[model samples]
Target chain A: MLVIRRDLVDAMVAHARRDHPDEACGQIAGPEGSDRPERIIEMENAERSPTFYRFDAAEQLKVYREMQANDEEAVVIYHSHTATEAYPSRTDIKFANEPQAHYVLVSTRDPIEHELRSYRIVDGVVTEEPVKIIES
Target chain B: MAVTVSIPTILRTHTGGEKSVSATGTTLAEIIDDLENNHGGLKARLVKEGALHRFVNVYVNDEDVRFAGGLTAPVKDGDNVTILPAVAGG
Candidate 1:
């Protein structure tokens, strides 16, 4: 099971909506504790593409350092699907390198209509996991 | 019993454009071997010298096989195997 904050989901939806027609990507940071995951970071992907998203490694390193400084961790990595459902595409599965982190997908094909799903991907396998949105 | 394996677009050519196919095996390696026998170069596309290709991800029934048990992951009859490539755009 994955625990995400309601405010974090809202922020992700808004970002996806704002980048409609193109994919939007980001990283979700939270405490490592399982009972209460406090989302503490929001990152914007800089890669430009309608079909793909490439996270900025430098920015990611910065965030990682920041999280380390704060004693928090990067729990989930997220991206938006501009024209598809929250289910992962072939490419999404292929590129998943972090087996321990939750992969969240936001469907913004219909910006006004939002569909969010969380997954655990490793070695090309995608497993849908139950997600809990904590209200903050 | 056999398991159903789904091929992604990048590797469809190896499977002769077939999106999904069937193989018989109790473990992932056996099924992969069966696939290689049926489709030429399929094993190369997915595995290199016994290791999974860096760009290919294999999921069984929506669960990543790497985390489950890698090539030794158990496969039950009717299980679905999905192959996906790393998407790097956006």
Candidate 2:
């Protein structure tokens, strides 16, 4: 049961569209607790794929540190598939470091085909989780 | 009995476009070597100089190999090994 914000999905879709032919990546910051497992604080758009992504390690570390400073945790990590579906690629699953974190994929291959899927990839198993979109 | 390994799109080119393949091994390392033997260059992408690729993640039945024993992770027949690349998207 993974809860995501509707706005976040929309943002991810927009980013995907904007970065067509490339990839869009971001992180989700939120509160951490059993009562409120995940909540989104903000979304970022990687400008370019620095060999792979526009955002570098420094930017990621900054965001992560900021989240920690705010006493928030990175609940979910997101990215877009400019020409692919919202399914976990073999590469995507292999890089599943945060087992507890939800991975949301937004596909912008077809503007009309807006698809957002969430999953929990622990170890190497990809498990589709129900995404509860919260509108704010 | 063989251990089943799932391939990702990025590395499929090395495996002759094979989405999944099966290899025999008692440990993950051996299985990886077997895969590379059948499919050249896959070993480099999966492992570098006998070490797991930094950007690539390996999972055994949905569990991250990082938390497991990594290359030494024990595997058995019918086990599913999924190879996923590290994707950074906003």
Candidate 3:
């Protein structure tokens, strides 16, 4: 199961909500090999297309550098779906580079509630995992 | 100079299923050329029309190559280069 904090989940949901209609994307970094996501780094969707999202190349570079300097790894790479289920698409599976990181998908299709799910996309295979939201 | 290049699984068929391979080059483009020499049919999937394919993102030591200098980004011993596709779907 993928363990994460409630606040972080909320932050991701909020970011997805704020950028509703267009896909939202971001990263959550943690200490190397920790399998924990502690810091949320929001990234701009360069495409800004409701059906697609490519991180701004420059900002993506900066985020990776910052993580390197801090000795952290991108534990969770996340994006939202504005009109679809909280599941990865073929494009997402094709772009899954971080085999060890959790790929989170949030669906804000419902105005009242959002659907959040996590997956492990390794070797072009997508496997959904249980998420444990910490109360503390 | 020797550097490590991490290959995404989707494109591993060209590398004989090797996840990471070492090539010699002082620059990103050179390294890719070296890789193409060692692992034939790999460069075409990554480059198009004299530049990196639109969906490809190459990073040298965690820094995106597009901003560092595109394919001209420098590389040295022990550096890790990663190649990933620009992801999107909803």
Candidate 4:
């Protein structure tokens, strides 16, 4: 299960809404082995396409180095699906390299309501996990 | 040239779980060959049809090898080679 803060969840939803029509992607980092996502690092979608999202190579390198220096790891790797359901696509499952991360998918297909779901994609397998939002 | 190769977590299985390992090569291709000699299965993961796989991002020091020369990017002594899987999806 993904136990995440309410504000972090809101931030991700806002980011998704802001990038509607194009997929938004980012990672939430926390102390190594802590699994508590505390920092939201919004990443530029290099592809900038409605159907695909990729992190800019240089930007990814920088963020990764910063995480290493700070002894943190990406606990939540998220993206939005503007017109699809909140689930991992074939491409998402195939490209998921972080076996330990919670892959969050937000859907903003409906302007009035949004759907958010989390999953674990490891070795080409996708397992949905319940998200427990913490108010504080 | 001796260089330090930082392996990503997904590829640690090929390196006996070693995060960083030393390899000798003047070009990225040569470094990959040397790494294959030691790690065995890494080349298959990083290379495909004689080129670096599209989903794998390789960096020599601070420069992305794709922008430099793909598999032929030059490396010198003490340089850092980082291999990160592309975080991407549809």
The TM-score-based order of candidates, best leading, equals: 4, 3, 1, 2
Cα lDDT, all candidates:
0.75, 0.70, 0.88, 0.97
TM-score of 3: 0.77
Assess the local accuracy of residue A50 in candidate 2 as a C-alpha lDDT between 0 and 100. Answer: 20
Expressed as tens digits, the lDDT of each residue in A64-106 for candidate 3 is: 6688689898899999999999999988887777787899999
Stretches of candidate 2 exceeding 4 Å from the true structure:
A34-55, B1-90
Best candidate according to DockQ: 4
Give the clash count for each candidate: 11, 26, 0, 0
Q: TM-score, each model?
A: 0.58, 0.56, 0.77, 0.99
Per-residue alpha-carbon lDDT of candidate 2 for residues B1-90, written as tens digits (9 for 90 to 100): 498887865677787878789988988899988987898888888887778886676877766777788899988899988886654532
Candidate 1 TM-score versus the reference: 0.58
Off by over 4 Å in 4: none
Worst 10 residues of 4 chain B by lDDT: B65-74
Q: Residue-wise lDDT of candidate 4 within B23-44, one digit each (tens)?
A: 9999999999999999999999
lDDT of 4 by residue, A1-136 (tens): 9999999999999999999999999999999999999999999999998899999999999999999999999999999999999999999999999999999999999997999999999999999999999997
Better of 2 and 4 by lDDT: 4
